[model samples]
Target chain A: MPGYRSEHIVSSYEEELTQIAQHISRMGGLAEQAVASAVQALLKLDHDLAKQVVAGDKALDALHRGLDEMAVSIIARRQPMASDLRMIVTSIHIASDLERVGDMAKQVARRALQIEGLSLNPRFYNGVKHLSDLILRQLKGALDAYATRNAAEAIAICNGDDEVDALHTSLFRELLTYMMEDPRTISQCTNLLFCAKSLERVGDHATNIAEAAYYLETGKQLSGDVEELQRVQHKI
Target chain B: MPGYRSEHIVSSYEEELTQIAQHISRMGGLAEQAVASAVQALLKLDHDLAKQVVAGDKALDALHRGLDEMAVSIIARRQPMASDLRMIVTSIHIASDLERVGDMAKQVARRALQIEGLSLNPRFYNGVKHLSDLILRQLKGALDAYATRNAAEAIAICNGDDEVDALHTSLFRELLTYMMEDPRTISQCTNLLFCAKSLERVGDHATNIAEAAYYLETGKQLSGDVEELQRVQHKI
Candidate 1:
């Protein structure tokens, strides 16, 4: 009878972990949607879409809170060791990162709301469009890495941030030049700069998730040292 | 003798928690120093101080790693419950916020390094200086809330972020107007804008710490609603 009860407890523990993962996936979906919708809203100057993206942040935050509570319950009830413990802890960390991603999307959506009625050249939106797309791809990969326990994918996403940072800097300069050329466009361009900065932060948060994902899957930290990371990335 | 041994273990556990608090204090001091030094470096264009601020980030990061390890060990060994569990979890989160504060300071310092030798009008740096100073005060209040377990201070720190955001936006406009006045200052003005943005983020991270600190002290999440938050502030 005792053996039967122990096995049942084990199965239920596994079930709880599954539920935690499902919560993460749901949050991930919302985060991805928020970023994509926010970017589209920005590029298209669609106020309705921007409002939807802003409103959608609440759902993501709710998912985060749910996942966090689930994590703490699992940790307390199961007192899981080693990787199980890491999984629960890492889930909490990753949920916070995803929540922040949604917040960044909200910031961009707010900017989209502000930058209405601006019919600038198609060229002005091109860099931001590309950067937003890059960030989306990075975010998706990081989430996939977390879900699938793919250390290689996580490391690649981490290394991929350099490109994101570079693009952000280039866009910063490009926006600066535009503002200098046409003082009239300064307000609009400044909004774009803030949008670009938020997107840059999204990439940074993705890097953070990828690193934590790597540790969750492999139970090892990504190196902070540039040379060490370079070698690891080279190998990967 | 067995009872004595059991009591000894309990005392040792309490001592370990004390050590954790000390680690947090050290981190708080480093975070405050990093922000102060980075801001001074930015305002004065002091390259040496900027480099020092950047370099000091590594130490803060090292402390974060140490705290994380300690937290994991405590959780695994003690299987802490209720407030005890929250203290460990909250410590981990606070360490992260402090680390990010250091990261934002490093961002400002890098901007300072980039803007070397451009002796502009004193007014150009004034707004940035004020913003940095305000952010530093916010960060200090948040850390103090954590260290002292003061829920009221935590609430105040969270509410104070509006002023920080308002100042940042104003500075954003101020810098834009300056750039518009003189195209030659666009690059430097852009740098200032980025610095202002970084300081603004420091305020954000500090607010995050304060919210988490509040939960650690009172076992309650700050209300996300403006009305509820206003009610709580009025009570405080």
Candidate 2:
């Protein structure tokens, strides 16, 4: 009977862990939707859709608060040690990253609203669309890695950040050239620059999530490879 | 004897809390120094100083990790509830914000390096210097509020973010005009725009810290006032 009671306790703890993981997955899904909606809103110049994306951020924020509170409560109640503790702590970290991703999406939506009614060059629009598509792919891949506990996949997603940075740099240079070519395009290009920046930040938050996943599986921080990439990009 | 033992436990808990607070203050000082140095580097076109600022971020990152580990360990070992738990959790949040503040400073430093040897308009330089000064003031005020557990002071700091946003918008417009007026200035102005954005982000992080302070004291999240301000600015 004593052994049976111990087994019951173990199962209960496992249940709680499963619940936290589910919450994180749900939060990731919401963040993914937010990013996709924001990008589509930008491309279609849909003001209503942009407003919807902006309004959706509150839900993401609330989910983050809920996940954080749950993680803290589980720690206090269960006193989870080692891998279990790491999982809970890393969930909190990933939730924060997801919340920031939501904010980035909202910023894009706001920029889309600001640029409404301005006739922008189609090439600039195509550049932003392409960049956000790459970011969205990174976001999805990182979330998948988190769900599967795949550190290798997470590292791959992180390495992809260099490509995102390179794209952003080229887009920035292109937009600058556009503005310099015709002063009339300055306002629209400026808005586009901000949109590009928001997408770039989304890629950054995705990398943060991937790093969290790597830490969760290995109980170690990812090395300085990403930082090295950032430094190299900065030099350029 | 029981009463005395309880008092001793309370004192030790207070000691742990004090230690965490001190770490946060130290981290904030590092972040403040980094931002000031980066901005000075930009104004003086000091590549070496900018490199120093970039290197300084690793220390901030290490401090953040130390603070986070301490907070998590406290939560696990002490099983703190109510205000004690809130304080520890909020400390973690504030540390993350400070670390990101350090990143923004590093970004400014990198931009300074990219624009080396280019003579920018003195007006633009003055504008960036002024913005950084305001942001640094806000950061210090927020830190003070956290140290004192003064929710009112924290709220005031959060409200000050709107002014930062307004200053950033004006700076953006002015830089856009500069780029338009002289295509030769495009590269320098673009770099300046990024620096302005970085400073603006530092202010946003300050507001995040202030909000965490308010939450620590009141056990309630600050309302949507800051978000409302953001939305209004987006409309502009």
Candidate 3:
């Protein structure tokens, strides 16, 4: 065990990069679980399940602290620069986005309890599920890119944000129709809207992760014009 | 002007660090202005001003790009290690928090439009304004700590977060009463609740900057058992 501990210590510069990447992968796993729990809670309207998802938030928060600690330790011990520095800084940002993703999931679970008895359009549920899946995939892809330091994969994931945004807009319009059709559906529809917004926000966090990955690989920005993109696609 | 360009070309490692610091300071200044403008629009109920603030989100978004560029450039050129690496990574997180601070200000402005005619309990407004001031001071103090490498100031700023949390709880309870007092206030009251939540979040971000500063100075987490503290405070 003593020998194992010493071997685990990074003796060379390259090993330090490997260590940071490992921590980021662990963080990704925690984020994936948080998102899964959030969707599960929404689908079943299960209060117990929702609370379990909320409880997972503590773990996710802990993940950020651990990642940050590992990062600071790496910087102190390794004296990394250039791409290595980018990786550490990017990990820090991605950790924050993941934590926020956990928060958004909790918000969805809160809405689930309020909308338990209320009817939701099957179409709306399906759209949200699809959006959640897309966000999950995007996050997975971004992490993969970070692990491999693959700029191409990172850019691909960044582009995937558009599809998520489109789904969110369509979901918004469909829900608005439901609210307008029946005033009695107002509260439930409103709650659902917030849930959809939460999912959309998860997509945004994924996009942020992707951007970080891209920067880590290239040390340059991708697009650098989120506003222009927004203007062009006003639906965002 | 020619002399300045010559100096730039001949700039030493320390000069680059100073240059990055100055740029971050400028970004922080812009972020501060954005928050002030957002709050001004809210207090004055100026929709046009609010719209302007919303539009200016692009500029804040652009600042993220600028900060990343500066950080990467510094890392590439200086190859800073240990405490200096912590400083650079800390700047990256601070930039992100300031960007979110800008977004929260925009959210406050949006809430103002929805609650145009409603009279908020003056106490609630005062509570929020007080919290906002505390966050502003915290941000300022955190930056000062970063500049001076002062761990004590950073710790003091972190302690101030508790005051903001207490105020948030009081505001939440007061808003709940307003919602219960009359259903008519529900919609507008909810908007105000979001505004208050946003301000509370700003305090949280400021606290994060302080923690980063502490890490830079001490090379160890000054605060004890983050997970335990998170549980006790229910920060998650």
Candidate 4:
């Protein structure tokens, strides 16, 4: 019976890993949709789309919970080791980052709803739209890198976050300048500032996922000093 | 020999759990220190202390790595199930949040160094100082709740985050209003906005830790819908 149980666990190990990967893909797709819809909602002040983005977070949360359960169950049941364990561990971190990305998008969508009734210059959003576009690309790249196990692309996403940060800082000043120049626009610009912040955080989450992917593929941290740790993992 | 091996694994299980708990405490302590020192550095514009806060993040990072290694090793070697496994898993998450708290404080300290050359009225920091005070208390409460396994306190910490969120928004407006009133104050207010934002994020991270703590202690999510899942864990 003990031998049979061990074999049974081994038989399903690859299936479980594949299921986790597929779940990650689905979650990434959902997260990307949330961020994309949030941008469209903000740009068009589309009430229905904003509502959908806000409501969509529940699905992402459910998926996050599912992924956590799957990871924990596999680890506890199969007791996978070395690379398998690292993959499961990294997946948990990546899923956590993706969940936060959903949260950021939800915040942005809420702000869009907040400023829905206001009449604003489209020019007001060009900077924000630009930031969102860059973040969306970064997010997409990160997801692709994770799926394909492209450590180079993952590293690129991490490095590209600085551009996102610089853009955000500049946009911060631009939004505040609008408030300063036209006191009438203060409320709108304040909401816009928060939206910009949400977008910036999405970029941060993307970087986190990329870093996690990088660690998964390389057994090394993007920030270094992980070589020794990998040795320990192997020894254990 | 196989029986001897099983006995050895069981013997070290408690020690491994204790080590993880102790590691979490140390990481939490360093996180609190980083936040406290960052506040002091910002209030006094003390460059040395700001540098110290920035440098302190490395130690927190090291401890996070150590905790992860310990958790992974125990799980792979001992293959602990049930509550022992949950404790190890929760410790990893708590350490991650604590590490992020350190990162937030480091950011605030960096802002302190950025604005070190500016001469300004200390009154400008009154709102910021108050916000930091609230955030520090929340972070400390969260750590203590986790240490004591007080799920009620953890839930209270989660509820208290709304106050922190509201305070951050008000401070955001307050700082922007200062900029509008005097364009000359824009740069200073901008930095203050970022520092305030960092403090707000610290509050958010505290809530995350509190939620994790709640889940670990109760085997249920603070936000509910986890009863079925605990049943699943028990079945596993």
* Model 1 agreement with the true structure over B15-85: per-residue lDDT tens digits: 98988989989998998899889989987789999999999899999999889889888889988886787
DockQ for candidate 2, please give it.
0.46
> lDDT per prediction?
0.87, 0.87, 0.76, 0.84
CAPRI-wise, candidate 2 is acceptable
User: In candidate 1, how many Å is residue A191 off?
Assistant: 0.9
lDDT of 2 by residue, A166-201 (tens): 999999998888877777777777787888888999
The TM-score leader among the candidates is: 1
Quality of model 2 by C-alpha lDDT: 0.87
Candidate 2 Cα errors over 4 Å, as ranges: A1-12, A117-123, A224-236, B1-13, B117-121, B224-236
Error of 1 at B210 (Å): 1.4
Candidate 3: clashing pairs of residues: none
lDDT of 4 by residue, A1-236 (tens): 99998888777898999999999999999999999999999988998999999999999999988888888888888889778888887888888888989999999889889884765566667877889889999999998888898887887787789899999988887776776677667667777777888899899999988888888888887767355434434554
- Pick the winner on TM-score between candidates 3 and 4: 4
Model 1 regions more than 4 Å off: A224-228, A231-236, B119-124, B224-228, B232-236
Residue-wise lDDT of candidate 2 within B1-236, one digit each (tens)? 99999999989988999999999999999999999999999889899999999998999999988897888777767778767877887888899999999999999999999985776577766877789999999999999999998887887888789899999999999988877877778778778888999999999999989988887777777764566445544654
List TM-score per model, in order.
Answer: 0.95, 0.90, 0.75, 0.87
Residue A111 displacement (Å), model 1: 0.7
Ranking the candidates on DockQ from highest down gives 1, 2, 4, 3
> In model 3, where do residues sit more than 4 Å from their true spots?
A1-15, A42-55, A58-63, A69-88, A106-130, A145-156, A159-197, A217-219, A225-236, B1-11, B110-124, B169-190, B222-236
Name the better of 2 and 3 by TM-score.
Answer: 2
Q: Which wins on DockQ, candidate 1 or candidate 3? A: 1
